[model samples]
Target: MRIGMMVDSYKPYISGITNYVEINKQFLEKAGHDVFVFTFGDLDYKDDETNVIRSPGLPLADSGFYLSMRYSRQAKKILQTMDIVHVHHPFLSGRLALRYCRPAGIPIVFTNHSRYDLYAQAYLPMMPEEVTLGMLQAYMPPFCKAMDLVIAPSAGMGRVLRELKVENEIEIIPNGVDLASFQNASPTPREKYGYKSDDILIVYAGRIALEKNIPFLINAFTGIAGAVPNAKLLIIGGGVQQYEEEIRDYVAGKDGAKRIRMTGRIPYDELPAHLSMCDIFATASVTEVHPLSVIEAMGAGLPVMGIESVGVGDTVQDGVTGYLATNDAPSFTAKLTRLCLDSELRKRMGRAAREASKVYSIERATQRMLEQYERLLREPGRRKDKLYFRLREILQRSLR
Candidate 1:
């Protein structure tokens, strides 16, 4: 199949969606499909295997978060050559694909990555909640209903769509990780970071924004330090300078200030080694649709501790693969302390986490996604309600 995968951003700008596209593209191509990425930004992938076409007229300000594109006549020419169009996000790229693909009798599948309602509320704080919901209600439903299939990373997001009365086919297909990358990487030495072999290392990787609830993790780590003086917190990833300063000040004022390390924006290649070095990985955010960091950490054979929210809960089986805490300082501290003090428990959960991560491998994810595309292609007139049933069958087979 010649697949046209559309996303707002790619390459130099790394995020969950970008990583999802890159990994799946590799798998899809390896499975003998011709895949072309339709995106913005300067992509750095090799030209032989995956073809990337840059779209024009993207607004400079909308580069990072939102995508703004002026649908070019060339896009119609591009759509004409593809067998299927897979949209990664429901923004400008997806909207344009929907506009063109429908009239051409091409099958288009949309994957909802981030929770737009939550994102709009955060970015557009001045707008009233009713106004925001009203705008979304007017804008999203038509785009969503027009698609042949709508894929969500979690059931929580699917629920959001259902609430909006989006009368289209909805499927829950969680984002996957590169299992081999994490499993094959060498572990980093704890002593290199001025920590003894026995010291407990807790790591957090992702955006350090306020909405990520970094303050809760900071306070919880502070409490954990009072109990385990040798505990170290390694914060990976970057954020705004002001927020980073606040975190620095808070860590400095704590009793075990020297033990806290902030390494901003580590490259993807180094993540596995860093994750392997840590005894436990944690995140306190409840807003994630499907967190790639949590999955990556588990793939690296580290037990995770996170809030018992929708997506996190589905991934972490409490006492099995990892522990889930209430979204509070004390609850987070208790879970962190539990894994920190018990090496045996950590090893057990870490192994379980690695095994559980196999279910979300990029290979399996791509294969199942391809099957969905094939089914949609074969039976284009299948009722929208039947799409969910077909998706469930695919998921069940993939799980096996």
Candidate 2:
């Protein structure tokens, strides 16, 4: 089948969505399916991967996002030819699929990968929460209903959609991680980064933005510092310039600031080695829609320490893979401190985490996604999507 991935941005902008699309495309191609990526702007940017169809759009600062209402003629032509299109971002890419692909009788599948409600609270603090939620309630349901199928990366995310009044059926599918790279990864020498073998390293690998709650993790580490002198927090990944600077300044002035090291934006492939070098993976963010980083960390054989919510709560089988604490510094720190102090417990949990992570491997996820795609294609008339198009056509004809 010819598959097209629609996103707001691509390459040079490393995001979970970008990684997911790239990996899924590679695997699909290997399985003898034609895969292509349709994105906006970044036309001048050279992509290392082939079959990336770029549409011209205005760049939205250094956030690595593009804003545009339409695709280039060439991109539209290519997109219309796809057997099916999977949309990652709902606002831009999702609407575009409805505009361009729907008329062509192409099935559009959308994946709800972001917690837009929490995102609005993080990015647009001035906007009232009720207003943001109301906007989502109005937008998401209709958008999801218009699609042939909607996918939620986790059950919690599925529940969120239902809360938004999205009556459309949501398929629960976990995000896939390339586990082969991490399965037997040799740990990076700790001395290279000025750490000893006995030093307890807790890693958090993802964007250091407002939604990620990086300061919370930093502050929680401070509470554990007095008890575990060798405990170190290694934060990997960079974010928006202003936010990154704010996190850096805050960490710099802390009492035990030296204990936390922020490695700004490492390469995607290098993450496995970094995970191997760490004893535990930690994240304070409660805004995840099935965090791929957490799964990747588990694949690298590190126990996770995360808040008991949505993606993190579902991924970590508390007491088995790692401990899930409430979203508070005291509770999170207490659990983190225990993992740091007890090496035996960490090893046992780490082993279990590795085994549990296999369920989210790229091969498994891709197969499930493929099955969904094939099933959607085999459905007669794709009634939900066709009904939408037929109504649209009727309305257009009536106006004429």
Deviating ranges (above 4 Å) for candidate 1: 42-49, 57-67, 71-76, 239-255, 380-400
Residue 237 in candidate 1, Cα distance off native in Å: 1.7
172-288 in candidate 2: lDDT tens per residue?
999898899998788888987999988999999998788999899999999999999989989999987888999999999999988889889988888899999999999999999
The candidate scoring highest on lDDT is: 2
In candidate 1, what are the lDDT values of residues 256-362, reduced to their tens digit?
Answer: 77888998878888999989888899888887888888999999999999998867877888998889998777877888899988889999999999999998888
- In model 1, what lDDT does residue 385 have? 35
Q: CA shift at 217, candidate 2, in angstroms?
A: 0.1
List per-prediction Cα lDDT, in the order shown. Answer: 0.80, 0.91
